[model samples]
Target: MHIAVILKQVPDLVEEVEVDSQGTDIDRDSVKWKLNEFDDHALEQAVLLKESSGAEVTAVALAADGVDQLLYAAVARGVDRAIRVTTASARTDAPAAAAALAGVLADMGVDLVLTGVQAVDDLHGQLAPILATRLGWPHVSVVSRVSLEGTEAEVTQEYSGGRMATLEVDLPAVLGVQAAPRPPRYVPISRLRQVMASAELGSAAAAAAAPALGSTVTRLAAPPQGQGAQMLEGRPEAVAEQIVALLRERGLVEA
Candidate 1:
């Protein structure tokens, strides 16, 4: 079986975020990019499946700063192939990115497409479903585990309220992975360097253009700070008395 894993590079949250002059977007040029955490889990899932079933795994990513390193890193971790798509614009919303990826996935004979349920930057959780729609393939989201037999796949998905549903999906399906069966193995820097120096990388042209989303951001601002915490320090009895008084003062308790 051939599987394609869509990888994304997202800005590390530790980096300071600043809105661009347009006020609708972030200033990408100033941000430090790293592999998206959820995508990291997705990659591990693909590698695990590949190891267990001898499936061919291809890691695909859009062209971007530090993407070559990410691809090489994947190769070092045992993915069989790496592909980088050429894209003109960096403003890839979930639908636009899915559209661009659809073109490349169509010709790759991808029996399974696995990616993160949501990117840290966008957190919209829209890419997998949209890509499946574009490909006319069945899709499952928030999938925690996947098992394959012959041409059928069984996936266990987690939902709100601690619920889970296991679905039997046919081949040529898409899954948005929420977690991997195991954590991703660490790849040494030397291994990554070896792949970067010698491993082959493939290139493809994405959809000619991305359609614009219907919405726009007018203003961007940080969330308002919450009320600061109050400290009660004393002997146990005194602290307890203070807490009771404060709660009664705030009408949280009947005096």
Candidate 2:
């Protein structure tokens, strides 16, 4: 079986984020990027399948800052191929990403596709469904486990409150992977460096124009800071009276 794992880089939250001058996005120039954590899990699942079932795995990502290194790392982790989709802008809405990916992936004739359930940048968690819609393929999200069987795939879907369900999806489906069965494996820095020097990444241009479904951000700003807590000292009776007085002052209780 052939599996295509979609990848994306997101701002490393450890680094402080600054708003760009445009007020609609973060300052890209000041940010350090890393592979989206969920995407890492998706890659792990693909690699696991490759190891267990002898499946061919392809890692695809948009051309962006540090993307070449990320693809090389995937190569070190057992991916068979890496492709970078060339786009006018690295930062795109989910619809645009899905459109570009679906166009290239459709021609590859992959048996299955996997991606993170959501990107930290957008958190829409809609890329899989959108890509599936564009490609006219079946799709499922919040998948935690996947196993291949002939032309179909069985997956464990996770729901809210720690609920899970097993589903069988026909081949040529897309899945939003919430996690792999196991934690993502580690690749040594030496191995990654070697792959970076030797591996070649295929490239493709962005597909047709993105639809008009995306929204325009008008403004962006930090949330307003609020007054900090006021400590209530003294006896329990005094604290209770203070609380009642404060609530009354705020119109939260009968005067």
Candidate 3:
């Protein structure tokens, strides 16, 4: 079987975020980019499948700064192929990304497509469902595990309240992976460097343009700071009395 994993780059959250001059997006130029954490799990699931079932795994991503290194790391982690799509856009634009990827993936002949269930940057919509809609393929979200037998795939979906359901789908389906069955393995930086030197990533032109969403961001600003936390250092009874008095002041309790 052939599996294709979708990878995305996200801004490292450790850095301070600044709004762009347009007031519609973050200042991408000011931040460093890294692989999406959820996508890392998706890649790990794909690699696990490749190891267990002898499936061919392909990692696909859009061209961006540090994306080549991400692809090389995927190679070191057991991806058989890597393809970079030629396009430029703010990573938050999920609709455009889904449209572009759907067009390109149409001709790949892959049996399964795996993507993260959600991304920190993609607040518009998750990519996997939208991509599946564009491709007219079956899609399942919040999938935690996947296993294949013949032309059918069994997947475990996690739901709220600590619930899980297993379902089976025929081949040529897309899954929004919440997690892999196991934690993602670590690849040595030296191995990644070697792959970077030896591996060549395939490139493809985006076959479709991103469609416009029906809305626009007119303004962006940081949230206003609130009063800092109050420390309660007293006896248990005193603390309880203080908490009840505070709640009463806020009308949270009957005074």
Model 2 superposed RMSD (Cα): 6.2
Q: What tens-digit string does per-residue lDDT give for candidate 1 at 61-138?
A: 988778988999999999999999988777567877887899899889899999998886563337899899989999
- 1 or 3: which has the higher lDDT? 3
TM-score, every prediction: 0.87, 0.86, 0.87
lDDT of 3 by residue, 27-95 (tens): 889988888888999999999999999999999998877888889889999999999888765444778
Error of 3 at 210 (Å): 0.9
Q: Give the TM-score of candidate 1.
A: 0.87
The Cα error of candidate 1 at residue 156, in Å, is 0.9
Cand. 2 Cα-lDDT: 0.89
Model 3 stretches with alpha carbons more than 4 Å out: 88-92, 231-255
**Local error of candidate 3 at residue 235 (angstroms):** 21
